[model samples]
Target: MDRAPTIKDVAERAGVHAATASRALNPATRAMVNARTAGRVHEAARALGYAPNSAARSLRTRTSSVAGVIIPDLRNPVFPPIVRGIEDALREAGYMALLGNTDGDPERERELVAAMRGRQTDGFILATSRRDDTVPGSPVPTVLVNRRIDGGGVPSVTADNAAGVHLLVRHLAGLGHTRIGHVAGPRSASTGWERYRAYLDAITSLGLDQAAKAVEFAEAFTEAAGHAATLDLFAANPGLTAVLAGNDLIALGCYSALAELGRTVPDEVSVTGFNDMPFVDRQRPPLTTVRIPHYEIGREAARLLLERIGSPEAPTKSVVLPVELMARASTGPAKPQDS
Candidate 1:
């Protein structure tokens, strides 16, 4: 009773063979066992406080049982939930994460990748991928999170950007905003480019007013970049009644710009953002935006990377999750124009 509970003990308690108990306990192989039996085995293991010997498993498998996760910046509110999900998924699979923040610097990202590789990590999940990245492929199994490249040879998990953008445009149009401008993110990033492309398509298809000055690109995802881009967009298209920002941070910039230009949101001008990140609802006038499943995206990315580590020759796959539009106080019926 005093000794540490073993798999044998768990099996005995679960009323199953030790081999069945082993398979049921392992996240990778649990699918092969009967679902009811697996649940019983997990319950018995939990009751007995039996923890798998990860160290011995690593020795036998000749793997570090560690995944290297590289993200752009943890400062972004959207990424923390994602990282938490990744850690939870990896931990369930008896693996650990070696995390690094690249701060959107290519050199720093490369250095972190090399360092993690040297540590004998089992695989990698990167959230800092760019569309035009020219770097050679990774030596180990790799999966991208929240972004993808142009060719799409690698596995990745991302939100449905085009669908999300279309929802925003349609909502604004329903509000009678004929002149909608866009504060787009950097085109180098997949999220930015896809949203921008979708915006153009949405406007043309919806028969909204479109012009050369209706769009401006932010140098980065930061608020400062959004602020500058918004100013430029408004200066060139003063008649715009609505603005769609690439992300929540960028939307905050639009709020500041509109205020400085003496435009009241949802009154003189309506605004919407993407990524419905944390605390956006707490803004002066709660932001209307698109909500992507940040946590699920991370979990999916980790799951894909683990599958690749188990079977390296598997064909690459991409996962695009759904998104929702959150309408709030920031968007409203367009103001009436002077006759």
Candidate 2:
């Protein structure tokens, strides 16, 4: 190439004025241009391999043009779409995204938060909030995704856990499942704690509280924790007709435990899970789970953080997205033999 492509070059190629080209290339000002003209300018800029100098832009705008995204476990399969949503939203605002994984460790979370802030991130989008989360200290704007801290200090977007659990219990009851069990996640997490409470409320509301002998709590949301908890619950209440798992990973542990006892799912014991995570439908029998809008949750969190970054004095807001029941082959009517 003769010289690095410039805004003038982009304007010449796109047949628009330099001011119009600049507006099209800038995220904050792009909306002021006509859609057709903006599209043409962007296409021309891309064809010429053009990117504005970050040093110059930062000096002029006093912004890093980057956002940090923190997730608890990237291997969980539920975070890819959420991260994608965050990235899409950030890109449209002319900000690059940086990701940090905690692997479910508070110390790691603190280190990552500090590292991102050191890199001059304009804000944070966190997917690792716990019940009493205190890792991400008060600095730049932060938004919690897929998780939240009760009596919230930060903006967050999450699915309605209590309502989702109620839907699951009602479905199982409607199918005649009475001797129901629960494989709950760790109590330290807001999701784990809230979902477990929801399960209790659900059973009590239906007058099935007496049938709650087979409850177990996984130390974490991992498969191993679920497996151990399920086995423990089954040993105590061998005749349980159904189980409500804290999340899909824990439900998988339930599957492993039930398999060891030679129990066929939905025939002897029906299983239900939360989060309706990716590929549960492809399991031995499709899993019946509560569906939350993961991508939308991520997008909402990003928007909230952007809003907070723009206006630091805004009151903290919580966005509770709705959930739905996905009844699949994993649940069935309770057998008469259970009596």
Candidate 3:
């Protein structure tokens, strides 16, 4: 087997001392060395396939060129784009991201964070923060994306969830859907809790408070949970003519449940989803949903994490972007069947 190239090899090839080659290869100390020397080191590195050992570099510079990205569920199409955005932004900044999935488990999340810490991640970009999370207590810098808890201790970048919920409810109300039910996600998640509360607020604001009896909570942000919660909602409120889903996955579950119950979307009941994920437009009825800037959320989260690492005392804040309502085939004017 071919031997792996080392810094010593780079130094010899570049005709410089090992320390000089190391400085030239590092982003921080590169400026300290002469530019011509740095250029020679770079040329030698490429020629020798000399990839610096990240662990060794971390020891010398007290900086790990690695960051951690925590995702909740990859099956949800919305997350892929968001993750891509983060990867793109981090790559441009010359940092590498290590990804972990928690599958909506707090214990799993904590374990993953601990493991990533053991690996010496400089910071964390967490998209899976539960409403009650110990992530705020992480020893390293942490930036939350897509979700946040109550305390403002950590930086966050989330979609305008409240606005999105309000828009979904308002659209259903405008369609004369007085008996509108909601398929809410798990209460443990801020996205579910906040959006569900907004759903209540929007319904009450429209004088549809009497119609809020159709609420059902999904066990998780998953199709199975969504289907189960939707079944319960329909059973409890058969008069419901419109349904607001916590997310696209839950919305899809609602679709499946409605199909088995022989109800046609936008005919007997109109269904609306949150987070206009990929391929929703190609569904049997083409979902009506609220579109959050998924990619921008990721980019903003990465940028915030980088900034917080640079300025640790910069007054932690949450940035909430706007949302847009997408009207489509899944929602329509209320049918008289509810009456």
| Residue 194 Cα positional deviation in candidate 3, in Å, after optimal superposition | 0.6
Task: Flag clash pairs in model 1.
Answer: none
Off by over 4 Å in 3: 1-57, 336-339
Candidates arranged by lDDT, highest first = 1, 2, 3
The lDDT values for all models are 0.88, 0.87, 0.87
Best by lDDT: 1
Q: Weakest 10 consecutive residues, lDDT, candidate 2?
A: 23-32
TM-score of each: 0.92, 0.87, 0.84
Residue range 1-339, candidate 2, lDDT tens digits: 799999899999999999999877765466679999999998988899888766776787676878899999989978998999899888766678999999999899989989988888888998888877663757788888888886677888989999999999999999988888999988988889999899999999999988755689999888899999999999999879999999999998899889998998989889999998999989888999999998988888888877777677879999999999999999998887763
How do the residues 1-339 of candidate 1 rate in per-residue lDDT, one tens digit apiece? 899999999999999999999888665566679989999998998898888987776676667878999999888998999999999999877788999999999999999988987887888899888998743236688998998899888999999999999999999888888899999999999999999999999998887645424999999898888989999998988888899999999999999988998989878888999998999999989999999999999999999988887677889999999999999999999866710
CA lDDT of 163 in candidate 2? 99
Residue 6 CA displacement from its true place in model 2, Å: 6.0
